[model samples]
Target: MANIKLKGSGYGQFGGFTPYGNVTVLAFALATTALGAAAESNSTAAVKNGDVIELGILPTGMRLEDAQVIITTAMTAATTGKLGFVYEDGVDDAAVPQDAAYFINGGSLATAARLRASGTKLVVLPKPAKLVLTVGGADNAKASDIKVLVYGELTGPK
Candidate 1:
């Protein structure tokens, strides 16, 4: 039930875009104890089940086109994660309820592979939101490293 803010969290606005207008690409690298210690425990630790890893922010009007979790180092057996978004205000909007697993839901993290969004669950944000990774199944102490890539486009007026 801990919230882990990774190195690149809240940095989507600074993420570079492709030559084409508003085509955004953001990447985040995560490692075990990369931030050194957790404020809650005051000790270096690994991600645990139910931990919410804030990856970055998606500005309003951005439509999430794709996302990928690349496991650079394998994790513990049965370790899994979900990729999704939450509103910046931390409240769900009734019109478009916040989906905690809108992208890769319950995807495996126990092996070295790239897990990509299925493309069927793309989201067009109504407002600025936080991209997140929710750890599941087991503690990820065995995970050495991982990389997250988020791809999107700004569909709203410039």
Candidate 2:
């Protein structure tokens, strides 16, 4: 589903064009090739010093417009690392997840600081949740193998 139409024209008072006509309709859906990646403790360990890892979930009726977080292996200072997203209320099967909803807040892995960061693409109609991707201030002694890549789409009823 893809339909975008935006037309505008209206300004009279003392400006000029005043015929009057403005239309805006945007609806974009259908995006899912099934791309995935998750890592925080899948081995290659080395994250400590304020490490809050999770990084996974969002498959049942997906709806994550876009997300990216990668730090191959470079975390000395980490520039106060932070790659975010959290909202998993599974009732009781807990494992450290109080509440979070960060869309790439305070993100930096400092190896030149630009490992990769993206989030913010949803003009409405984005539900079907269950997401967790956390990594804040990874210790420092060279943080260590952290990778998280979450791509979106699957707006229900493929």
Strongest candidate by lDDT:
1
The lDDT values for all models are 0.75, 0.42
Using alpha carbons, what is the TM-score of model 2? 0.26
On the 0 to 100 scale, the lDDT of residue 93 in model 1 is: 77
The candidate maximizing TM-score is 1
Model 2 lowest lDDT segment of ten = 28-37
List where candidate 2 sits over 4 angstroms from the true fold: 1-48, 51-60, 63-66, 70-87, 91-108, 113-130, 136-150
Candidate 2 per-residue lDDT, tens place, 21-140, comes to 222221211111112112323544444545555544554334344555555554556444444444454442243232333346667654533344444444211222344434455444
Q: Give the TM-score of candidate 1.
A: 0.75
